[model samples]
Target: MDTGMIIQHRRSSNIHSLISYHAHVGAVTSIAWNLFYPRVFGSSSADWTVKIWLLDCFTPIQVLDLSSPVGGLAWASSSSTVFVAVTDDGRAHVFDIRLCKTRSLCTQQIRQAHWPALSCVVFSPFEPVILVAGERGFILSLKLSPNLRKLHKEARGADEEKLKELERQKMERIISTSAIS
Candidate 1:
């Protein structure tokens, strides 16, 4: 089955080339583009793979294999530094585009953090981080490096404590009001 299609009209041929691409051995169901590069990317459910292609080229430039069907794909435009792909098994594969012409360096792989499937992945515009949304209403933000993760954890603890203190004050206010009445 044709997963995704793009059509181009040629004046000389008086016809259009209907190009249909399959992401994997299975059907290519969805396609995404890199905002900062002239590249196109697509994913398929049948074979659970993500393929990257140069614009106007039918052949894929790179193929990323996944253990489970792919649910989402994303590319960073800030420097064309990274490409991220998420799968049904809650695994995210991070690749470095700079090394694509030489060695295939998978910068990072996150596993078992998401349940069901990750439906979408996006990068933060203000920071070097990624946000993933998964099935069962699961939302998570993954930082590129360990330093960010540690800072995030510390910030979360502080926020939780602040919330708890606010709750305690709210309860005290209600008790005093009721006692006076």
Candidate 2:
């Protein structure tokens, strides 16, 4: 299977099967997993829609209406709490994936994040932080709240250990020069 494709391998027979998930009329561009439910999320290139599928039933759980072709997708770990998607038109859409039917009740949108098409979007390893990458090597860091933003800024700018290491190296260089002289 490809990087985005999910596959199941049979141990005994060494046979692999592609997990039958969604029925998309267009090419499936990206897929993400729902943290709360046994489901997978996917986006289509031609249809410009996001689809959620139940794992066991292999059926589409929901479809999100979008205007541009989807380029990337990600989900929050808090179970139907937040889902993120980027489009070729440089728009980022965040939505609630809590619904069971093929429709979402509420939606939130972020637009024009990149000048060109966006390539990928993912949640930070630290949680509540979203990382987006796009064409021209564009990258964006987004925080869910002001508190999260403060924490992220601190983490990104923290340099205590590096400073200490630099000091140690300078001292060692000085000592070596003195001994040589």
Candidate 3:
């Protein structure tokens, strides 16, 4: 078993420990930081769960159970509340927290059962596609449908700052609702 810890360091000083907790019962397989929100990140573990965390909290805001070992995970480049986690059983679990927090919005079978386990998943920054890699030297690119790529919309001529704030608020709402539930 491995514990998850966050650390911060400056160029002129030694690394300082921030918060440490038992994030998983098994080894953590992958960790990804949300591109749109600096304070939010996610971790997947062999315990068959993915946990979403906030920088200021020790407990995870949400835990998703996949019922199989998670090989890797990656946050979406265009949305703060969306991510994909690959499992050892050759399934790709796509989650959009804004739509549903209890389960993945969609699950795709990227590889056959006889094929090697998927090792990693990454989202394309320029498009609504994801590339999944397997342990046996195979890679598959998947194009997300319109439903999976749905994102919050801003008014016409909205500034960049306003868009960013909307993204931040979206994540904040999920976090707050998770706390209550």
Measured against the true structure, the TM-scores of the candidates, in listed sequence, are 0.62, 0.60, 0.88
- Candidates in order have lDDT scores of 0.57, 0.57, 0.85
lDDT of 1 by residue, 21-135 (tens): 4335565545666554443444445367676665566666656666677777777533343567777777777665443533234434444653567777887877878998877
Better of 2 and 3 by TM-score: 3
* Pick by lDDT: 2 or 3, better one: 3
TM-score of 1: 0.62
Candidate 1: global Cα-lDDT?
A: 0.57
Return the top candidate by TM-score: 3
Candidate 3 global TM-score: 0.88
State the lDDT of candidate 3 residue by residue for 1-181, as single tens digits.
Answer: 2554434333436655554556888888898999888888999988899999887677889999999999999999877899999999899999988889889999998888789999899999999999999998899999998988765666246677786778788898888887733
Mind giving the per-residue lDDT tens digits that candidate 2 earns over 77-125?
A: 4324356777787667766432223333333354465376777898875
Per-residue lDDT, model 3, residue 32, is 91
Model 1 lowest lDDT segment of ten: 146-155
Clashes of 1: 1
Candidate 1 vs candidate 2: the TM-score winner is: 1
